[model samples]
Target: MKKEPIIIGIESSCDDTGVSIIKNRNILSNIILHQEIHKKYGGVVPELASRLHDVNITKAVNKAIFSAKIRRHEIDAVAFTLGPGLIGPLLVGASFAKSFSIGLGVPLLTVNHVQAHILSHFIQDANLNKDYCPKFPFLGLIVSGGHTQIIKVNDFFKMKILGSTLDDSVGEAFDKIARMLGFYYPGGPMIEYFSQNGNNKKFTFSKPTVSGLDFSFSGFKSDVLQFIKNESRKDSFFIKKNLSDICASIQKIISEILLDKVKKAILKTGIFRIALSGGVSANHEIRRAFMALSKGNKKYEVFILKKKYTTDNGAMIAIVGSLKYKRNLFDSVHVSPYSKFKTF
Candidate 1:
């Protein structure tokens, strides 16, 4: 028997309010409304983000459903992001999902925002999704703007966090570094683009050694700051002429540091299958590094998510939710959103 295929996914976990429709493996419509309103602030303003999500969630969802040429009642299941995000934003999305599910008389599935990322591979990677997929009990590195974690995924619902950042996550550092280099607010991509022509050997950046497989990026961030300050003492245009090289060098160092720790975690956990998900994982340098780490190593088959799926989105949550629904896993309508709901 074929499963009832329509699932509506709502993502308001952060500044981006996304809605997507997934009928099994194919994506029918995915609409993302990203707020660049916080550009001047240099970081996401929680209140502003929540407000934007509230305003955009319905519009995005309507667009998704309409573009897919489907009615609300056609949606068999409703899926939503539950935690590890701004409470106001998550609540806006979560409550809407629950209410909509009730009105449509469909089952409700609650998806962990992080796990949605891994499940993203199930949608983005055709080889993994339709053909050769990883078996149970894998390792996943979940890196994003706000969170960084190395998790041991024993199953779909059960996993353990082996390591995480004590301070800033990798993507946050990228944005900060971009700002220090005098780029736009969301300077990560600009930094990566400029980094192409620069010399990584021009500067020496130190890697932070966290206890065990856990990580720390705060010290490395300070090192970058002090390095920039010291270089400015020699020349006013120190960052101007050397900006590309500085960005390149810093990006390379950061990528290497991440891969190194991930390798260590792989060995310690003895997990053969490893997957990466998050905004930072979209970085080409980091992706290349992860690919290099997985090559010819039969003990580990590394999973890489498509760049489009790496950032926060609704399809991932919907996919996770659909799978859980098939297993009779559902969340109550009485659930409320959480700001700091930590679970591995």
Candidate 2:
């Protein structure tokens, strides 16, 4: 029997350094080392992130290989996130991946970070969701700290951006709003937790009027800031008294804006199958909203990656690597990490 090729995936796109190994679409092992120091600053510090990645990459990769119980010779190729992230972080992972590939005399694959998030759904699952998979010609919502986009995925490599944010991403809005509420860095989960018991209609924020499927959240964020400022001046303890309500209202408006665009994309593409990816997809309210929307319409089918793969992770990178490797898509040795890149 021919042995399936084993591939190594490395990710250092932001604050986490991740490594994973996969064969035949099955994830053998996946590991992620998060930079916790950034929490003190309420957001990722690029230099700190890159420094931590440098410290963690080697150990992360070694652990992944050991957990996979694979010898160095078993890895057929190496894949790494190459763009659309902090240049320093990208370089850390890209450099490591290139060195590993050369040392192993294996092929190299450079993955687009955002595209990897969309492909994450294809990662092998050994649990109850093992058989779950979405067909082609679907809408993909990419929501993370750095990006918010609606993509029409016609095939593995054929994709079209239906819409994109003109300013802040959904995750950014969550974090920024959470900051306004005096929450720590990475406030998405905190906001979601508080929103559960609050009235979502307690506050109203104007949505952007961008034509077509494009989005604009900068104005929404500014409105939120202004609202909080005005309310605080009226009542010194306004935020303390209405934290839950504020969270609920903010989450509700963001969810509506995102789904509204998805609705538009559906009409434009005539596709009923939609998938949600990126870190923000982990938000309970957003997940619920997407699922509810799909259930309300018999024609809609929504796909969301497992919580583990929802964030920046190497499993997504590995899955994309495996797919590209099958088609002999390999990167040259001289390929460099890019700070900015676009996916079709």
For each candidate, give its TM-score against the true structure.
Answer: 0.95, 0.97
Native-referenced Cα lDDT, model 1: 0.82
The global C-alpha lDDT for each of the candidates, from Candidate 1 onward, is 0.82, 0.90
Clashes of 2: 1
TM value for model 2: 0.97
| Residue 268, model 1, lDDT | 90
Residue range with the least summed lDDT across 10 consecutive positions in model 2 = 124-133
For model 2, how does the per-residue alpha-carbon lDDT over 285-317 read when each residue is reduced to its tens digit? 788888898779878988877789999999989
Model 2 segments more than 4 A misplaced: 126-130
Assess candidate 2 and give its lDDT.
Answer: 0.90
Best by TM-score: 2
Spell out the clash pairs found in candidate 1: none
